[model samples]
Target: MSGILRFLLSGLAVLLTSYLLNGVHVRDYWYALLVAAVLSLANVIVRPVLIFFTIPITFITLGLFLLVINALIILLVDFLVPGFNVDGFWWALAFSLILAIFNSLFDDITGEKAKRNQD
Candidate 1:
């Protein structure tokens, strides 16, 4: 159940990114859903390998290289999925930053602990 909800939220975040950014286009909600799933899978599978290979650069940049990795993942998804397009590297970078913001906001909104009383 949580997985389904998380997927839906991620899809919504992708749609939001499409709307908010000029160079990113999601053809429809279905495409957004597919993009979200692929992006998640890429993050899980490809990102770690990338991090391992780029550790020296990542360390040199004081962890900022992760943003580049995130943008690359977005570009990878764009390449793999039709109907979801990211125009260029700059656009992918902007889309990735915005998507991260939206995903964090979504997590806060849907988080179980968020509903718990502070008392």
Candidate 2:
């Protein structure tokens, strides 16, 4: 299904991000998959709530606060998942940015955009 494909793509993105960033560590592809799943779930459940509560600050910062929220989610996943580690706050922030970039690129390369048109 498309969802499964998206999940795998996200895992690949995580692996790619870890490879490019010095302070981010993913033990293996399995851990990358797990990290991707957790991040997806957190984005669905936790991120919206955090964003809702931080709307004022998010607006005040001209949307920059979302980056901090993304870093916090990365740190949360680091705590909840084993074998995936982000070195520090700065590294986590960097990791989030890189992961986002990689995920977008992977989605585009894998025909996900074309699939979206059909849906």
lDDT of 1 at 58: 98
TM-score of 1: 0.92
Best by lDDT: 2
TM-score of each: 0.92, 0.93
Q: Which stretches of candidate 2 lie over 4 Å from their true place?
A: 117-119
Residue runs of model 1 more than 4 Å from their true location after superposition: 112-119
- Model 1 agreement with the true structure over 36-86: per-residue lDDT tens digits: 999989999999999999999999999999999999999999999998999
| Model 1 clashes, total count | 0
lDDT of each: 0.92, 0.94
TM-score of candidate 2 versus the correct structure, residues matched by position: 0.93
